[model samples]
Target chain A: MTDHIDQDRPGRGDGAAGDAHRAKPTSSAFEIILPALGERPAFEVGEAVSVRDRSPIGHYRVPIYLRGHVGTVVRIIEPVLVDNEAEGYGRNAGSRLHYYRVAFPLTELWSRYEGAPGDELHVEIFETWLERAQ
Target chain B: MTSVHTDHHDHDHDHAAIEQVDRPGYYEVMETAIRELLIAKGLISAGDIRHQIEVLDSRSPALGAAVVARAWTDPDFKRRLLADGRKGCEELGISFYDDTQLIVLENTSEVHNLIVCTLCSCYPRPVLGLPPDWYKLKPYRARAVSEPRKVLAEFGTHLPDDVEIRVSDSTAAVRYLVLPLRPEGTDDWSPDELAAIVTRDAMIGVIPVTIGGEAA
Candidate 1:
């Protein structure tokens, strides 16, 4: 029954319009930062990472495009300070460190892709949506 | 005038038949599923989704038209556009900064500007409309910043060695759009007629607005 509720909203796809509805009503208390470069945070190649829910503050990098599609961890990037999408509510302020790189095989993304194995699309995605791969 | 082409017809028919069954990609399937789920859950109606899609489809060409028309009749507006793009669009009733701060860069002979969101496909959909499929691809995004001139050349847009190339990266908070240079030979054309030739790709600076039509 809960699944039914997820299906009925208009403009579920994330974009400019969706972001407006989703932006944090107020600033958060914490200062979010990007993970620093050269610091190898440990994660297995095929680990399933859970992306945090980001409906409150609105804008997110984990687009609806890659919700269910699983990708392997490719690279880690330097952390920077930015607003936290999850905690971005009215008057809340905080910062968090987030990973920036992942590699998704083009064939895994588009089943019809005939490119060679080396051909992979590297996307810079926020760490919220990732989970340990089962 | 086909004298002996007995097997050609079969080959053509087979190719056409195969093309028709080329399955949609995973993203397309996921998009459909999400839309269906949203509608079923009462989050939004199917009609609303369709309407949004329709808006995206029509938006690009409409913006192209507006920019082209303004360039033809209003010299002051054109000057303003070159100077400050967001302000110039406002004069024509185009809104850029309501939800996010949008920056408009002009592509002149001296400096050419291109936009890309290396993190995600951040675009000014309100002004220029939905981004094209190609624009959202990883290759275009990655190369637009690192090797803009080479990528532009792939799109058949080759700037001279003397020209400066500026690549703007869109982030979660900010986005950039390009206002292409007005085409020549449109000195006396009406706004409506002039807008007819403005393609979405041109407004993005991947191609130039041609007096004749879309570039070949």
Candidate 2:
């Protein structure tokens, strides 16, 4: 666990680095049809979301890079019983909230991103950390 | 380097002269003390610990590969898996050792999904076994969520600029798994043959599963 994969493996990087005009792929998305939940979700799919920029001390699940960023809600995880912040302290007696899968554009995530316009980064953010974007 | 003389060829020389290493970290010492104390108090037996570790070690990437292969061939199973990753795997007799939920992300030409634990190395341990050492390290945890396209390039996965590189950060209770796109020239292959090409990196989303890729 102490070892790092910072360096590339001994016999890898076959696709080569820095190859412009990459070949177009033949396959499409796997396209899994999601069943609807009777219970209403906090935020609907495709809704714009803004992550709160709260700087809480000690154990927290929200990554610093994602704080105060706007994204779209990809999926809503049901049952809403995760308070990993409190659970990390060995106790989970606090109120629960849903963990919505939010998809942020890679360009918005990193300023120097040179990938395609459709590229994105998704993260599971608790309802408390997210609010309806203006 | 030791100079070998032909006169000493009759005796077997010990080339493996490395010293016996001990648990050197503070947590390692603490863990040893607590474990020994617990054993002495008859709380948990050494056999129990060994059994748990064996169970963890036995869980390789093949389990996830099998699920991917099934999804490729069995449309009904794939539908159930995307809806509920835990239940779908459970139907296949894959037992989840923990309570965390597993979210299976489907990869398409439009978007490629990658999993990362920015907060820590949280992974789908029940199916994919332990996370790689690099996965638990600083570089991947930091770069994957930020410069994801560049990170994918490190693994030799050069996707078109139009392809959406979706990086899923396992920051909370949910664990993410990428259901990679079934490569071309694999349509005629059996479930077993398809599974043979589905590798750990493809599942992890660092690389796509190629036609003649190494099996997990």
Candidate 3:
């Protein structure tokens, strides 16, 4: 599929040249680390992994959805460091290790889920909440 | 057998009593704890918190409805919207957070975009208000990235199979809001009438707006 890079220049297509003026170089550390952390080694599907609860912060990416859900390890992503929630509370200052692509069975999550037995929801989780599932 | 049965009934009654041990309900306990902390720290007055809740509870759906209506009538304004989402909204007098950035995604024939925080539920609350309960589910987050079409399907939304689904994962730095395609028909309709058809789900790209039973 051809990707159209919409030129921010005004009078090209639309008269408003405001987007061009506001277009800044995207060189933030988050974008830089995202790519690196996205390319981690792969793991086999259905492998078990223990999931645990994480400390709360003012803002967090770990939604309340998978707070206590147990899931299988599906893939291992490149390690990325993010703001530590406990540390953000003025406790210990450190970056937390996290992985991407862990899969959980639909039935394991909700008893009434009627999807196929093999249907799984794969999610990214932090290292602290994971262990080798028995 | 009679002595054993009597002992079992006594044990069951004791268990029931233990289970019934009085404890504050979840919402009450949480509210109390948070209130206590805030009061102890003097961060805000109780009256202030109550007033904030009152304001939040009193918010009507009119503001969002107006924004949707205005965009439908003004082609020039839509151009501005396609360019700068926040600034365009400001032009319509809809003020959002000055601190955070909101990115708007447009739906086209080739690709469809959906937003999910995956890790946590991060919503454009200032514009959209409270998020639906399903939005906070782990299943929604995990499925949104892997199988967006399926997740949307649960919300009674279906796109052409050939269309590529692009799911935007919101983080601390950026937030996303979807802009659905305009519905067909109602060419002669006024802006107010157009806005009436533009639901919040349409703005979030979960559903397309329809005009006079025609797809936008």
Candidate 4:
């Protein structure tokens, strides 16, 4: 099979551009989770979690603007086979991570928001990027 | 199962497209060079790569639509889908080879859902096929996260002021599938009949499923 594609579909690279983010490592030290691996997840459904405000210098999944923002946990997703931080360096530590979908109010995320007051942004964030909301 | 690698032999599906679109771009050139080097070094075989592409090409939105239609007509299946997405898909004979977890977000009268991959177009490919061209554009990605209502408006998906809109950014390994609310006045429709109207856009939450016979 040839690698050529119809230029008419310029954005049809199968998400290859996004692969860079998955391959890079975060500058900040890996965040720690309570109970580590063989125990219960740190956050529960509907629990509030504050995304850590720390800025990492390398590839990471957590959106920068959402850092330090508070959101309610929607669900505790499956375990991450390799922590993204380690994956950036082409290392597979085989570390299990608790993933959570946190829903943040649009108003809280933007200063001049004009959408519905109840509008929210739900993102799948790794457990390390979250801290118990005050 | 004990062999080094088992032959799939599921070549019954057509591969005409694979033979037609063989033009190699710069990335393809690079990829081919790398793959050739690896093959020369006895690292990986060309057959492995071909098999992988064939597997991917076989996937399409039709698979996801089938799952959605089943959910619409069967309450038991709907419950299973909402509770566990990946398993629910498996129960319907849909399985993903990758480790990415599939999460189905159901839209309702009070709440609306939209899927975007702001970081990159990390889409649910095993079910809904490749992400559309518009989905990967930077404008769509940026505006979808910062100004989703406006983005939806452009897609002609205008929700009432009362309904809350939620945008899900697929930033991690978890892939999202928007389970759009079933259209009204279709209670007696068959699964295959209902699946016909479930478009790729509807599954992505960019548009709503139509009640009449309008094709998506």
Candidate 5:
């Protein structure tokens, strides 16, 4: 079941890209504040962690299938741009969160997965949506 | 190549009677009207719009291909790219349009990478141009997240069964670019020649670059 039923409008070539690009000046502010904070990522690459099960009522990036599943952090991307809390509303009030590329087993996400046992999918999750694995 | 046509139409029929069906849609008319109105109100200039159009037109897969070629030939650049993608791209004189960070995912003999935007078409437009219509379609978005291997197969890409497929969804502001493994037999090739063989799909991780041939 997909929640993307309202994305029917078609016309490419970066209309949203124009709206968001260079429009927010806090991006540079984030760059200056990030190093000063010296904040370390919560999870390390190859460490097992579980996605937080919080279901917010508004727009979010975390897919529904990955709400409570365990995954391994495959990569730690640099802290840049605002999180969903700010991006969804075009506001620049939230702090930058570390983005992690977590790999999850396809079978774990779907019981009827048809791929091999080695098959897996990765999703970019913010530090706020991840927790230590149980 | 051969041209095939239906035989139902008679050659003697009046071809001049055909009507021209080309016309702008309602939204297009509205867009032009709004643009003209904005220009009239001094909110924006026509030159500014032209400049913005030129900026987008200047971006394409060639920019990304050049970056990959540099990383392939220079070990230090590859290290820089893997360590910090945005900085590495800027080292090559590529400008960043926004604050979004670019992440370079390297493909190896054991691991493969594929990128998608499940929420909306949030892509690295500064490097790669606008995504293809198929990439923006609903089918590709949903299927890529659910069954990436099958989606690759649909694109005529087949990897070894033993190799691992890592499908990374571009769910946020970060954009991912796949650094495909350098093809064999290109040891003596120049960066320009190597870059020519790299396709947009290869950088997207749907297919691999052919060593001595065209797009693979």
Candidate 6:
């Protein structure tokens, strides 16, 4: 249906484009750091991980449904930022980390999921909430 | 005591009678109370609040449409956008109001992308402004990840059985925007024309952009 779309165009699939575009996903080439809290990101793309099951009190971003489920890290958001679990309580005093675009099977997310096996539910999870599931 | 005007300059206009919500909901009441208290404490001025509202109201889906149109017309821009959403949007002269990063998800023939904040109503506010009411409601937040196909069907978006329904539950500060597949017929169309056809729902991934009108 999208024949009018330029099929000859490179980097048209999955939005990955190429490594050229992936140089730095930021507003500018150089970012000024106020205070870097976390070390380099732990997990890489395509790594299997699982969400940490513990629930903390007050203003947490992680949904309860994804607490114990396993997922693959599809994409990693760059420039390690303030942890949401910390920021939600009005401060990100020390916590800062990368966010992983974790993809899980819809069937795994929900029992009796009325969709194909290929269906997926992708969620952006913080480094603190994830563990190596390999 | 306030002075009363002897002559009121009320003109009959082609406007429907302004209606008020029957009652302020829970959050609405809290908002008004907090606002009044804050103003009373002299921490914030009413004008500042009004100015903030104006800034938010100024933002709309047009900004995002312009970005999408640029990506569709220019392959390099598309590549940049797919790689880094915030940087690509900034390249187009679109400003970011928030400190968080924006991620642009592309829809392909094999996979369809949908965005939902199962935890809360987190959207690409810098580009598309405020979300619709349904987006913040319980049902949309609850079922969007669990039963996305059914949700898409409700929005009049139906993909082939084979296409993957990839739902992104934004559980972090990072925001999401669905870079919808540009429709076929508008190959020769200008950027403005392309932008005109891109709807808010398209960016939200609930529906695809069509020439005639929105699906169903």
Best by lDDT: 6
Calculate DockQ per candidate and list them. Answer: 0.04, 0.54, 0.08, 0.54, 0.44, 0.60
lDDT of 4 by residue, A1-134 (tens): 34222122212112343344334543533321112242356677888889999977887898787999999998888644456666777875655667888999999999898898999999989877898899
In order of DockQ, best first, we have 6, 4, 2, 5, 3, 1
TM-score of chain A of 3: 0.51
**Per-residue accuracy of model 5 over B103-138 as CA lDDT, tens digit each:** 899999988888888777877888888887877888
Q: Residues A1-134, candidate 2: write the lDDT tens digits.
A: 53232232322112232121122322333221121332235577788989999898897888888899999998888777657787778777654767899988888988887777777788888777888899
RMSD of 2: 16.0
Superpose all Cα atoms of candidate 5 onto the true structure and report the RMSD in Å to 1 decimal: 13.0
Fraction of native contacts under 8 Å reproduced by each candidate: 0.04, 0.90, 0.10, 0.79, 0.63, 0.94
True contacts kept of 6: 0.94
Clashing pairs in 2: A5-B134, A29-B108, A116-B161
Stretches > 4 Å off in candidate 4: A1-38, A79-81, B1-30, B212-216
Q: On a 0 to 1 TM-score scale, where does candidate 3 land against the true structure?
A: 0.54
Best candidate according to TM-score = 6
TM-score of chain A of each: 0.50, 0.65, 0.51, 0.67, 0.67, 0.68
Best by DockQ: 6
Candidate 6 Cα outliers beyond 4 Å, as residue runs: A1-37, B1-26, B40-42, B214-216
Write the residue-wise lDDT of candidate 6 on A1-134 in tens digits: 64322233332122333333443444543332222234556777888999999977776777888899999999888877888677767778767678888999989988899888999988888888889895
Q: Regarding DockQ, does 2 or 3 come out ahead?
A: 2
Q: List each model's interface RMSD.
A: 9.6, 1.2, 6.5, 0.9, 1.4, 1.0
* Worst lDDT 10-window in candidate 1 chain A: A31-40
Model 5, residue pairs in steric clash: none
TM-score of each: 0.50, 0.80, 0.54, 0.79, 0.75, 0.82
Ranking by TM-score: 6, 2, 4, 5, 3, 1
Q: List model 3 lDDT by residue over A1-134, tens digit each.
A: 33233333232113123353335445553422222222332233456676666655566555566667777765444334453554456764345344545666556766765434544454555565566665
Model 4 in CAPRI terms: which quality?
Answer: medium
Which model is ahead, 1 or 2, in terms of TM-score? Answer: 2
Model 3 Cα lDDT, one tens digit per residue, B10-119? 34543222233456799989989999999889998889888877655543345555665666677788788656666777786666642334556667776566777777
| DockQ for candidate 6, C-alpha atoms | 0.60
